[model samples]
Target: MANVQVGNGVHRKHAKNQRSPEESVTEHESTSMGSDYELNGSTNTEVQTDKYGFIGGAQQTPGEIDDVPPDVLRQREVKWLEMLNSWDKWMAKKHKKVKLRCQKGIPPSLRGRAWLYLSGGKVKKEQNQGKFQELDNQPGDPKWLEVIEKDLHRQFPFHEMFVARGGHGQQDLFRVLKAYTLHRPEEGYCQAQAPIAAVLLMHMPAEDAFWGLVQICEKYLPGYYSAGLEAIQLDGEILFALLKRVSPMAHRHLKKYKIDPILYMTEWFMCAFSRTLPWASVLRVWDMFFCEGVKIIFRVGLVLLKCMLGSPEKLKACQGLYETMEHLRSVEPRYMQEAFLVQEVIDLPLSERDIEKEHLSQLRRWKEARGELHCKSPPRMHGAKAIMAAEPPSRQDLQQNPTIIVEASQGHDSNIENGKRAKKSKTEKNKDPNSSGLLNPYPLATDQSQGLLKEGTLQGSNQSLSSAEHDTYL
Candidate 1:
């Protein structure tokens, strides 16, 4: 049975009996055994044992983790030390190798720091040292407080840290989320932000977690958690396009029932697969996701679709969207293993170039359809349900109503925006700003130019993806 650690107390139910005192957890390793890190504010190191003498808690027992041969452990330790000692060099010049290293997995002891580096959180934390506290000290928007409060315990209820109603985990979750609301009032607080914050808190301290969340929301997945969720909708369409090519049988079967990707994929994309994949797999996905870009997500999604309903027989069984969702969510744990699923993701033929090309193609269609936004009932694509509840405007809307797009694009702070665009040449200023790579299609609700708003938006297409069998030519 799983052992439940309730703060300072260890509650053992169905697990094995306690170990011999000689074999009891050591003072140094007890707290850090599970999750590769101690839960914030947890001080008790005594691990309770079940009837079978097995240790239990939110994580695997020490013996289970120690099952790895000492030689392998030592080798990993050496690699971890090498990574820590030469972090800057790895990040700057040898990032491709760093990606390969991450694919193997980051040492639990070093995962926090590695994630910080991967997400650029270390620099972000330094730049915004007191910002979180400043935001915390101020009163939060009344509108979002209740939502945050309601969603606190929902984050990681089974985990010891967040199990209690007013525990440190939930408190930190609130502070991090609330600070984000204060930091970016326009986006306010979205329910999806809670899980991401909760996952960050699980691995790092509150302040560090806060900055990581900031990097994720503002930098990693721009426009993702905003009120409209335009990015999710756009990506849903992109996924549909990819599905048609990757798994035509599954794609067509779903379309036969008019089952849309949005119905099942919204939460998957919104939470970065945090809620969809198991904890172990989720961490592995994060390891790669931070190293690469959102391409990891698309690839993972493809693998999931292929696994869930790639065959005609399986797809035929799903009578409707609801059934399709159930089948998708019910994928076996064995197949979703971190190593196996990640290897499949790596082997996937999909590429960022594919997603970028699809995104541009879809954006052009959306741009053509902007005049229909006021129709109050946006036309569904091929009779599929709308992924974005708030329909995005067409490109014509940007040309005709430039001010709306300009104002909507201003939600982010100027410094944050500068970080996104970097430097421009004097000669570049003479050219049309709209024609610049800076403008891209965002969603209609954002009323902002979304086509090329960020540096990462179009750059993914240029990167080379190595296929499992061969290098892809894009």
Candidate 2:
């Protein structure tokens, strides 16, 4: 076998004898998984799959088992159905309830639909009808199309959907990624986007998955997949700054070892932890991420650091950068359990304002260290809630007027405008329901509003590492 270098230092081995691309890909898939599998079990199946369609075998250690009873799931499904039916009402007037439901976890049956709603992908699809099909039909840039082809089978090989080399899963994955490159030709394609699109395809059809990918690349995370990857690099600095407050010990250990945040966090943040976390935990995090925004991602990273490197004993084994990097790559199962990680994320005292504050600090630092940053785009609206609240102008509006001006009300602060804080006038402080463009969904609980925003305080009465067991990653 001959090894061929792929992106991100990953290598794929080819047979000694030359073969066509399709032949090599088919050979690769067949040899990699021993045999092909399908979504529904076949008579000749070699392994049993779990509820989520991942192949289960003696080699794979079970991470977290879903303990929620069926009846409970059914009841939650009913509630979710109600919320979905009245999604606008829930988002408008009962946002707290929506947030609470999302934190609890969206029912598995409704996860795909709820994600479409929460990501604002459904709205984007409705607004731009038949756009994905148009892009899919067009011949994409040959450069990106080839790259996307090579990466198709690399995503979720263990899952039945992507096990076959030229299966529907791989086909849909190619379409979504190729369409994205066509949609945003300037950005082209990035390897990290393959897993994200693959995960979306697992839940929804190709068209919906494409829109979800669009929402993620354009709205939830801007400039993340662009040339030079300047946005993700900037966010890496922001994550390091946040670690100073979230877990000082972990932050200091990394500083002492001179481990750059980008070294370990690139996969974690860019793929939204789809590659790093357990399958169940990945879905749970995405549920919150689509609802909230990048804050869920930041919180997850902080939680992992706090669990793995917060203590001296845990840091002792990680004496050097290689050990630390290995430890991060192979996360301990206990730390990534779905229920535990979700709760830690909910309790963590990290907020959007904290991220914004650190973002500004990091930008200044970057400018001082390395002159002007090219391809640095302005930050987009944070999450689904913020996106819906802002009600961004339609594509038609943008097409008609290339530059849309936003008029700031007198004496009112516009954080999105200049990233500077301003004092509100007396009348502005009176809390008018309609003043801020966002309707006041519910009366803010004094403590709930201000509690998690406090520095150096992890709320919810549950400490990050409550158990005494010290488990190390293999």
Q: Which number leads on lDDT?
A: 2
Candidate 2 local lDDT, 445-467, one digit each (tens): 55533432252232331111111
| lDDT agreement with native, every candidate | 0.60, 0.72
The window of 10 residues in a row where model 1 has the poorest summed lDDT is 465-474
TM-score of each: 0.66, 0.74
Instruction: Put down candidate 1 lDDT per residue, 240-329, tens digits, no spaces.
Output: 888889888878877877877788888888798987775667777888887776778888888888878888677666878778877887
The superposed Cα distance between candidate 2 and the true structure at residue 321, in angstroms, equals 1.9
Which is the leading candidate under TM-score? Answer: 2
Q: Once model 2 is optimally superposed onto the true structure by TM-score, how far is the C-alpha of residue 85 displaced, in angstroms?
A: 1.4
> Candidate 2 — which pairs collide?
none
Off by over 4 Å in 2: 1-47, 56-64, 392-474
All-Cα superposition RMSD per candidate: 19.1, 18.4
